[model samples]
Target: MANVNEPTTNYVILTPEGVLHGFSQVEPSEQQLALQAMLAPEQTMTAHEWVERYSEIWLDMFIEEGWVEVVDKAIIAPHVQLDDFLRYVSASLSGSRRVAIGSDEGFCLAKMGFTQQEADTLCVAAADFFDFLKRQQQRGWAVHGHAISFFSTIDMLMPNTSFIFLWINNQGYWIIIEDEPLLNNRAFVELVWGIKATGERFNLLAEQVLDKKAQLESDQQAQAEEQKK
Candidate 1:
């Protein structure tokens, strides 16, 4: 017998397409409260029985009141090149004033509507913020292992503008938008997948280049040794 008066937990559901939907519990109605009271001490009533009984009183009400509805997914085509992906993401986030992608090392890879200096500065700030967040997580302040996204007000950029920072696959994504309604999960999913894919692709390329360079160095050293022999 759990306390029915306790606050219900909030739920976040992520669809396959990368859209995130949040559901919050509504306040219990008089009838629902009465039903909870009646069932409070009823040890014989199974969990299923309680749920079934409550559904009869509240399910129809929720449906009639339009409490739930489907959200259409934003279709984003897959992009192989990082430039193409960033361009597409910028267009999709039409409400945003500026968007930038950068590495964990504080180097801006691509940006829209931001000077190179500004973007680089922002990327460095984001890297510092991410390091702070990781330290907090290590200190037991954050229950999750890592932070996915966060919002902040950036006075450095604009007085009333909002900054959204997303951490995906060791890449930092910055979105600057007006202080209105923030970007929804539908568009968010695209950035998540896009960043992940491009990050992995470039990382692989970097690894290959490093491997080739190491091989060349090894061969040059071997040649010098043979000449001495």
Candidate 2:
């Protein structure tokens, strides 16, 4: 099996020699069992069994050593300004919590937020980063910042801009903001932590906001009809 640290779109891998896939009890059902049996005819291990083995191997080999994790989030709302982005970045970095910057762009950047000095260091690094993007341009790659723009380099670029780039730190988490928002609001952030704290699960936070927006639209239409009457 491939390492757990690396997630791939295709959970199953078929080689002429053998078929490989991970299994876990998190999805314990007869349907899952039948699928597993079909996939691995020899061992016919249950999904839960496979997952347990996979997780055990991961813990033994690649358990993240410490204080940083970059998680992905959904992009379901308008983007924020560059100023607001920096503020959130500042707060995340000042604390020891694991911070992540996700985007609707497709990938997310996860890692421990950096301090002012570290951010400054990244600014210096951005020069080189920009240069790298320039080279990749010939192949259809371009460098963009937080906001949408025809320009290739980022300078006072708008926040919540759409583009793909890798954000790295000394930790295991990294972000590749491609099509999602890097969440940094207090209420939302707290909601995320709250979910994490209670081991509760939910889909992307922005989706909830979108749902509320839809409700508001429906309500407004009803009010308009009453006013006409």
Candidate 3:
């Protein structure tokens, strides 16, 4: 673990293709896992707080990674600036404990906690996903009905602001902000490890400040009734 003196670098890959998506009862072998991604610190970013982090820090990372380019004042949220897409990829699922990862080639698993190794793994995953998004853009695929727009090359013409692109899955996506505040504190969702948009499991987001599921269930039930009618 980096001898305690250096800043602890942990790897938190929010993907299910790892060594642990299946085999619920058994842990996969190390060779199947990204040993560098051990566990992330057990903290979550509250919905609004997550936005704050994006504005303050992560927005820059997204820019550096080619995920987004500061566009206009976030027409969505005033305090939160707007970001246009550079590349997009999405998928979804939620549930926690343990990290599993793999591509078409293989898979492995890691426990969810905090460690330098986990951070390193996350770093690699972040970089890989960034590249993946770029590839998807070049292919001219319409992701969520929108085409990719690379903003990194035109920073001189466009102002930089903090914004986040999100994750989507077979189900939907995880979002904390809406036109209206969902909670008394205005914190709809929180990401302990920053933003849990990896589309893997909700484990990273389950630890929450507000229970939005109650509303989700109600919406589902209402939709079911309407369908029957």
Best candidate, TM-score:
1
- Estimate, for each residue in 1-229, the C-alpha lDDT of model 2 and write its tens digit: 7798994332221111111111122233443232223233222233245445454343222213211112232222213433344344534333333233332232232323444454344334434444455476657854333223123446634332222232211111122122233333433333222222222112345578899999999999999999999
Model 3 lDDT per residue over 1-229, tens place = 4576874332122222221221111133332222112212333223233334334354344335433223222212112111111001111111121222222111112212214465345434434544555587679853332111223345544311111123322221112111121112111122211222233335446644135777788899999999999
Model 2: which ten-residue window has the lowest total lDDT? 13-22
Clashing pairs in model 1? none
lDDT of 1 at 132: 74
Q: What's model 1's lDDT at 94? A: 41
Q: For candidate 1, write residues 114-151 as lDDT tens digits.
A: 68887788777667766776687678884332223433
Off by over 4 Å in 3: 1-94, 98-114, 145-188, 192-229
Candidates' C-alpha lDDT = 0.48, 0.33, 0.28
Lowest summed lDDT window (length 10), candidate 3: 81-90
| Alpha-carbon lDDT of model 2 | 0.33
The lDDT leader among the candidates is 1
Model 2 Cα displacement at 150 (Å)? Answer: 32
